[model samples]
Target: MSAFEHSSYPEVAKLTIPDVSVAALDMGCLPPVLKRFVEDGAMRMQAPVDFIVVAALCSVGAAIGTSIRVQPKAMDTRYQIVPTLWGAIIGDPSSMKSPSISFALNPIQSLEGEMRIGHKNAELEYKANKKIFDMKLKQVEA
Candidate 1:
């Protein structure tokens, strides 16, 4: 045995992390309508374009769950895969998570407001129609 081998010496170990390759953003992955919104949102919010786009997609997907789905292959057993998703952004206190998400989802909030107004109007109309039908039924029964 060599002197170094016979002597009491510490062993040094080398560790290596594999190189990972990530593809560039493909705008085609998003619908044509949303591509513009994502681009605009990223610019307006002064955040990473990819982050903004992904967050927007996640929010929209949750909002429209079960309404739309994907069938990847004809031979698949399931009818479709629901487009539901959940996403979270973790960062330090100054990361501005709330502002970024709020900026990205402002359009959704606006649509929700419009929908609430429409629902209120529809409810009032239904109540009025029910009252009229009740009166008509009472008259017929008299």
Candidate 2:
């Protein structure tokens, strides 16, 4: 008889799958400053610390951009890891996930506002320079 035959296997009255267990977040794993921020935000918003921590990590990863990379193995320089990170805070409706994420990303949002202003100023300067160059070219041609 082939082992693949259904009769070869023992029949069970019932099959049970154990529940998945998730470990709790360890605040010590985070830097002191970040830990404090997460703790404060969670307390004030009455949200889970995990949400803030994940948001903070994602924000940092985005802020770093593509300029930085990590080498998993020092001996193998061929492989490089980007700082890109994606995170989602899963919670039922009325949960404080939105507020927690907003709190964590506040600093990043502020920086983005400043960067936008700088970019607008640079764009205006470029337009002014281009107009001056065009006038100079017209004068030289005539």
Clashing pairs in 2: none
TM values, all candidates: 0.69, 0.78
- At residue 110, candidate 2 shows an lDDT of 100
Full-model lDDT, candidate 2:
0.93
For candidate 1, the per-residue lDDT at 93 reads 75
Candidate 2 displacement at residue 33 in angstroms: 2.0
For each candidate, what is the lDDT?
0.81, 0.93
Q: What TM-score does structure 1 among the candidates reach?
A: 0.69
Using TM-score as the measure, the top candidate is 2
Question: Which residue pairs show backbone clashes in model 1?
Answer: none
lDDT (tens digit, per residue) of candidate 1 on 1-142: 9997866787777978669897988988998888888788777777666766767888788678788878988899687887667777765676667777887788888998999999999999999999999999999999
After superposition, which runs of candidate 1 have C-alpha atoms over 4 Å from their true positions? 1-28, 76-79
